[model samples]
Target: MAWSADKSYFFMLAKLLTYSIFGIDARPVEVEVDISPASMPKTILVGLAEAAVKESTHRIERALVNSGYTRPVDRIVINLSPADFPKEASSFDLPIALGVLAASGQLETSLFSEYSAVGELALDGVVRKVRGALSMALQARANGKKGLIVPVENSREAAVVDGIDVIPVGSLAEAVGFYTGVLPIDPVPFSWDDAVEEHGTYPFDYSDVKGQEMAKRAVTVAAAGRHHLLMIGSPGTGKTLLAQRLGTILPPLSAEESLETTRIYSAVGRLEEGESLLLQRPFRSPHHTISQAGLVGGGSIPTPGEISLAHHGILFLDELPEFNRNTLEVMRQPLEESRVTISRAVGSVTFPASLMLVSAMNPCPCGYRGDPKRQCHCSPMQIERYLSKISGPLLDRIDIHIEVPPVPFRELSARTEGTRSETMREQVIVAREAQRERFGKDGSLVNGTMAPQQIRKYCKLSKEAESLLKAAMEEMGLSARAHDKILRVSRTIADLDQAEFIDVPHLTEAINYRTLDRSSWTQ
Candidate 1:
């Protein structure tokens, strides 16, 4: 190869647009490649790239050679623009490889100016799937790019975003051919309405539970208002069974809510292959041993955690007291704010965590304090210690507290089913519609998340209801927080009944939900 400083050398620089994911957002990056004459061939990757990204140079080179493309033998310098901030992930490999080919004058194409590419290259020239392709597609569309070229495995998720074409390529050769006009690939077809309607159904339902009708009703109220719920029962009491079916009784996810929730899942690589959008409400049941970072969302790069994964859905924590106390304590902020901000040395990132928290716990260390059939083996002090694992402030954040008792043989063996999830969901949807009318069409505000001022404005109690609540507050020694929670729960119950004002029946039901606050619970 011959190079002249004035002729060929001046044309050896190429720049292609790409994106890096930060938090749940996509940040633009320019992959700039420059080929200059050198005594010995070498390649340098200059940017604040983490080890995962820096390791892509070797992979991309092998992919280029295996794909029948030559690696530039000159001094090749690749820079990811805006080098101040850190970048991670192997998704940058495709764009960098294409930039090198274009800079070396081996591939001729004008698609670099119109499309953004994101995929990891395999050693055999196959383009592997990458995380955050949906986010990257959104960013590319926002930047006015024509389309986004992604791996075939990630095309469905990226195609979920409209207004921009999502070209699915299987191999590096296919991508090169499409860019060079040698191959034509159509954009993956997406029907937003049809996809959402087809995927909104859940497999579990409340009707599957044979007994515990009171717990079922309380769970319905919790879903109607997006309230956090806690159920205490002994082993094999249907607590876990009820929690799993909560999503079926909640409102089906709307389009905007589904997109917001799906983005978090896409950013964390949680989306299953071929799954386009998450139409059904998410139900995340994390193990009790999860750390604070795993629960909230944190890492060197700040990926979304389980709470964010459960956004616009339910987060069920089974065996609640078994979780580390500190790990559970960290949820206080996210529970109140509906978002968690994880600050690191690089910067701070906030992940949306608007979710209904459903938790189950035993009444005592022996798991039989309240069971009539089972004998209670734990001492009074041990019972108190077990219950004390859950802090009062955290308890205050939850809106509903109910006892789940063991199902008798008669109820379990009977063929008759309890209330169905479809019926409960219809009531929930009606209540949610009333809430939408009160709090605008966005549906961001619900009874469970009302502010102090909003509670005063919307939760107007009837005279009889007011009297009932006053008596219960004085007798139960309820905190001010618990007082507000009672009003919110009462408001939701009234909504379920399609009543304009909170009445005595609604207030009474709400007051009964504060079971743990009673003075004689530990005794």
Candidate 2:
């Protein structure tokens, strides 16, 4: 390599890396760069460079010059570490530009090795926030890096990961100055206790809902057991109101669960600016127009879908029958397994989707098929077709299916006097605690997700209850899956009452919840 006229002998080598935020799990990547003087001046970035990464050369060059740094008029080759793993995004711009400047003897490269760099560089040299900041910070910390230089907007998101030092900068120069000690930067501080106290609970409390005692009880049981629930009713029957309040009754997520939820939001580029951790459980309600990929994830590099984003939270599907059949069908596997595996030509990525599914649909297209006041205009075939949109297997996976009747004028106008969310939440918390003790530390083994062995062990029914369930299953033509679901739901009801065994009342509630499976109604 020929030396420049300055003969300062620029030899800056910088660390480069990629970040993986599959769902909420963040993994680090290594990026390495080398620059040299050659007759032809060109810059090439290798290591599975995606479109955004390949386009970074221009952005980096402009950012460097604008930031009072010169781009070496030499053939430059920048290689991202782990050459086999794919690189995506404009985050590589700042690192590549800094590396080139340091190698050209324009800037010092000594401190570059100690810190992980992540930010999108603008044409005017501004460092923009990139997606997956939390994941990047985690990767940096895991690799034993001292700290991370991220964009200001992403500082809070990255700081959520404890023990990692996150240095927020406005532009490339600020990062360079901090690293070179020209300007000292402080790490963003966070306190989980403060976050909890500040974000106590949701603004929409359960007490706000009125005249749906049965529905409220169902919500409590579902929240306690993390069971999937389906509500059928005509329009304006308080289905959505009931569904919205379900989150308020649920217990707060543990620290680990909160982090897992935050990571997924970070990866999908949905994390709010300057927001650190998502203390509350997520509630994702994708529109009926959503495609299969939009619901379950897609792409050459698969990303999380709505269900994954709703992990550790609720996924409310209002007007459920309106959703595409194919889209609804895709949820069957994830609902059963509590995770979704997205397969592409590159590889398969599994995202956690352990969400409480709350879906609402009308009895028929006109939404008045079963109403006493209004006549059902639709034919029998129309009703059957609308209901058929949802598959049997998917229906069987749901633990509770109740009819939500519209409140009468008297009830709707009645004074609001119901249990507050705090009160219901306390009860739900107690019930959940009871379950946690029975199921152990792993939250996945809740009553709704119990296996055959766990069901037999925990859901030991009284002789009368067992006979009632068997008779109900045969009479309703319920599948084996439905039978299992009934047992799980009955166990949850029993747990709510602090009952040791499934009793007659618990079995009755469980059987009543299977409203859709009743042959007379569908017929």
Candidate 3:
């Protein structure tokens, strides 16, 4: 390699790299920087870099100088290979800076070649935490990297990635010391039990709700089957209370599910300060004013939205009808597909959105249309208009629709003798286990998300159960899609009872849950 006025010296240096945490699959990105000093003093970064990545030049230069390194003033050009793909974020600062230093003969590249580096660089050369540290670590492991150097703040998140070495670095000097073998980096060990001990049931429990046993039952079934639930009730009727308890009754996420959930949270920069894995299922309650993009996930650089954040968890819409109709309408596809694909002129990105939807709304404008104690002030037309705001297609997607009446004074003042969340959770877990066993052999799904073919094959009904379902469907004027949902719910009910097949009682209970559709059309 010879340096000339027109041709710069070519040096091929290898360094460990990590991928961006923005996209799905969390693929590893190789950060290859070609540093050459031939022309007049200048630094050029050549790659498909967004503003954040382009700005890394200033951060890297300041960091290198502050970290006691001399920058080659000779014209230096750095190229991040696979240059066609867009790179965004400050996480690349440390890697790009290290690559430049190594290529410029300031550091040994061989020492850092086996470990991926990801962090934001401060002007003072401190390593700051970057979003998607977990995703980066996972990508490092997948790419056969031996270790990862991440910011201390993201150490816990990166530690969740098993079978990989994660080194938490506080500053550029610490990272340099580890790479040069002057200072050894230790992996952060995480214990699931310790995480559980610290969080403790997430500060919300089913026992907190005073009453509304029917709504609780509906939610229990919803959790067991992963069904979408809609609760119609007046204000302060414990609808929100019941919705909050839905997560407690659900089963804990499997290791794979926890990782997937963590990836989405990391991508959205929602992973808590010290949290590694999201041990508990997510509960995302977006406000009614949220846009369709906010709900489904979209940006110039696509990021996980509320529904994606709620993946493998619960998505609760407090005032179901209050949400913009367009916003609600956009969810119908993801509800059926378990994922959302947002297309932009730049490109298209898909995000997982498999979640149990728990929505609540008033029966009428006055919030007293069906209340026993409160007199209805709204007219029939007003009530119809209010209910009509929720599209039938959206209503149809909801597997269970229950009317949550105000809790009786006696029950509210009672000694709270009903089963606690722990007990109810045990039952729900048992039911969910049965569903997992039944569905695990084929498609990865619970009862609620089963396909029509799965319903026909797995939700086998007895003669009596078939007759009961037929009569109910005819009476309720249910659609073909609703019919499958009924059978799925019936299957879950049978599983809850430890029954092998759908029976009359299970069908009866499943039919009872479709109260909204039955009442709305029948009345």
Which candidate has the top score in lDDT? 1
Separately for all candidates shown, the number of backbone clashes (residues 3 or more apart, or on different chains) is: 0, 9, 0
Provide the overall lDDT of each model, using Cα atoms, as 2-decimal numbers: 0.90, 0.82, 0.81
TM-score of 1: 0.97
lDDT of 1 by residue, 366-482 (tens): 888878887998988888888889998898999999999999999999998889999998999999888989898656899999999999999999888888888888988887889
lDDT of 2: 0.82
> Candidate 2: lDDT of 98?
70
Tell me the lDDT of model 2 at 343: 74
Q: For model 2, which pairs clash? A: 10-103, 10-105, 12-103, 16-30, 16-31, 17-29, 17-30, 17-31, 18-29
Better of 1 and 2 by TM-score: 1
Better structure of 2 and 3 per TM-score: 2
Model 3 per-residue lDDT tens digits across residues 214-328? 7777787888888999888889998877877677778777788888998888876888888888888888899999998899888887877888889988899988878999999
Candidate 2 RMSD computed on C-alpha atoms after optimal superposition onto the true structure: 1.9
State which candidate has the highest TM-score.
1
Question: Model 2, range 349-369, lDDT digits (tens) per residue?
Answer: 888898999999999999998
TM-score of 3: 0.93
- Candidate 1 lDDT at 148 equals 96
